[model samples]
Target: MSQYKINVTKLNLWYKDFQALKDINLSIKSNLITAIIGPSGCGKSTLLRTFNRMNDLIEGVRIKGEVLIDGENILDSKIDLLSLRKKVGMVFQRPNPFALSIFENIAFSLRIQGIKDKKKIETFVEKSLKSVFLWDELKDKLKSSALSLSLEQKQRLCIARTLVTMPEVILMDEPCSSLDPLATLKIEELLQYLKKDYTIVIVTHNMQQASRVSDETGFMLLGELIEFGPTKEIFTNPKDKRTEDYISGRFG
Candidate 1:
């Protein structure tokens, strides 16, 4: 495996005639938490989508330069979309649990990969739910519909669904934006534990959350990365004026 779990080089993205990213060159180290922070519509989420080719689904979306995983260009035509997505998992802002049973929600990804053995699926489901700290609460309710879960529980279920695939890199797009303060703290703690095994890139509007969860932080504005470094330095003593302004809440 390469030193960087995901390496983006001179990456620029366009949606029709509107440019959303500009010369975004970033290296995300393996098994670390890197936070992408910026004001709304500053292309933070746009940059995150490029990692797993989620932007490819958007109409008229064009990308320049490369997004590499393990030294291979993921945008290459030879790449398998399904396989790539499995390696690079995504957890959306909303919980988005299927209307199916909770057990089915967690099993969805594994089933798609053609793992039909009941015993293996059972074991994997239990293990994944345990990893997300949802096993005790969800064990008795596995057969219940996912729609019945609370917002926080559903979000953890969504995380369990993502974990079932054993992805190397996980992308979180403002995951805690919809949760309460306590729930948000739980998710942050979960992220700290998760980073010990998988590389994580989170797009968060909460500067404090970024500081709390991320090892490295990138501050972006107007479709450009202004400054990126250790979380403490970027938050306390940013080299760029734009970064300092954003961090100090002078202007979002």
Candidate 2:
């Protein structure tokens, strides 16, 4: 099998007449955290959304490029969106847990797939929570409303909900943006644990978080990928002047 999990070749995107992403190319490795970092409105999140074709939800969006997952082009017109989404689950900037019991939140995906077996759903719920280190704390409160949990707990629960579907890749778009420092640290720790089992791509404006949690880092500027390399190299010794400037607080 190829070491790389996702590949983007000559990718470009436009919202109506305004281009959002310039010719972009990168390869993301399997079972590792890849961070996309840039200032506001630099298309960091836009490129992240392309992996699952989430941009399709917007009106007047045009894309021309190849985004391949497991050697198959997901940008193909005939691709299965439902299956793609199932494989590439997403966690948003804020914890948007459903207004349901904690148990039901995790089981929601399984229920949607027509999985009515109680035993099976129960097993997945336990396993998913365990993966995110929430099983111990939440097992007793399974019937409680998810909204009642603390912010960090809620974010962890959201991640657990994604895990119940057995996705290969997890896309986090500024997942810790709304989190407090302690909570963000906890989430970053969870990312380290998760990298062993799933490929993770994160978009963040937090430079320290990117350096701390990601194995690979890609820097963007004005809708273009300016630099991409091992996190250590990208931070310590970037090849591109633009990347160095951004990393040095010269300019975003």
Best by TM-score: 2
| lDDT, candidates in the order shown | 0.91, 0.96
Clashing pairs in 2: none
Q: Which segments of candidate 1 are over 4 A away from where they belong? A: none
Residue 202, model 2, lDDT: 98
lDDT of 2 by residue, 82-123 (tens): 999989999999899999999999999899999999999999
Q: What is the lDDT of residue 248 in candidate 1?
A: 91
- Candidate 1 per-residue lDDT over residues 1-252, each given as its tens digit: 466888888999889999989998888899899999999999999999988889988999988989898898998878999888888999999889999999999889888889999999999999999988999998998999999999899999998898898899999999999999999999999998888889999999999999999999999998998888889999888999889889999998
In candidate 2, stretches whose alpha carbon ends up further than 4 angstroms from where it belongs are none
Query: How high a TM-score does candidate 2 get?
Result: 0.99
Q: Where's the lowest-lDDT run of ten residues in candidate 2?
A: 243-252
Cα displacement (angstroms), candidate 1, residue 14, comes to 0.6
TM-scores, one per candidate: 0.98, 0.99
